[model samples]
Target: MTNPCDCDIRLIRIDEVIEITGLSRAAVYRMIQKGEFPRQVRLSVRSSAWVLQEVREWAFSRVSPTGLVD
Candidate 1:
């Protein structure tokens, strides 16, 4: 298995993801349903989170060369 510290695989909850991506919770879920966003990792029966890097990359991917979301 990979070391969490070495890989920087931090998991972020919904609230932090919303703050980072500037997307509403509903939008996030909707995008996820359409396969436009990264899916969350199930931590337990009632908890899930997104990979911080994946979320960041997805947000970055939405940006165009003109520095706007496409």
Candidate 2:
């Protein structure tokens, strides 16, 4: 078996998510509520993060080769 470090498992905060996806905070939460975005993980009482790879995949999946939503 391979160690986790060998894989691309990483957690990203909301700010990074916003930067990567170009989605507003409100829009992200809205998509999550609508079952459209990657799910978040509760890290503490009032903080959360998303699986970096998941978000990357979701972002890529939403856009077509021409950079338009498919």
Candidate 3:
């Protein structure tokens, strides 16, 4: 098995998700509460982060079926 240190994982804060998705803080949190979005993993009692690839995949899934990139 590969060493854990060799794994690639991009961890990001909530603010970064807002910047990447252009969604307001309330909207993001609401989606999280509803379990409609990728939830942040708790890193500490007061801190959390999300997987960057999960965010990217979620964004890709939002693509319109009409084949237009928006």
**Quick one: best TM-score, which candidate?**
1
* Pairs that clash in candidate 3: none
Per-model RMSD to reference:
2.0, 2.6, 3.0
Ranking by TM-score: 1, 2, 3
Candidate 3, residues 1-70: lDDT per residue as tens digits?
6658786888999888988888998998999999889999899999999999898888878888886667
How do these models rank on lDDT, best leading? 1, 2, 3
lDDT-superior candidate, 1 or 2? 1
The most accurate candidate by lDDT is 1
Better of 1 and 2 by TM-score: 1
Q: If both were scored by TM-score, which would come out higher, candidate 1 or candidate 3?
A: 1
User: Which residue pairs in candidate 2 collide?
Assistant: none
lDDT of each: 0.95, 0.93, 0.88
| Per-residue lDDT over 1-70 for candidate 2, one digit per residue giving the tens place of the 0 to 100 score | 6776787668999999999999999999999999999989999999999999999999899889999897
- For model 1, residues 6-36, the per-residue Cα lDDT tens digits are 8668899999999999999999999999999
Q: Worst 10-residue stretch by lDDT in candidate 3?
A: 1-10
Off by over 4 Å in 1: 4-6
The segments of candidate 2 whose C-alpha lies over 4 angstroms from its true place after superposition are 1-6
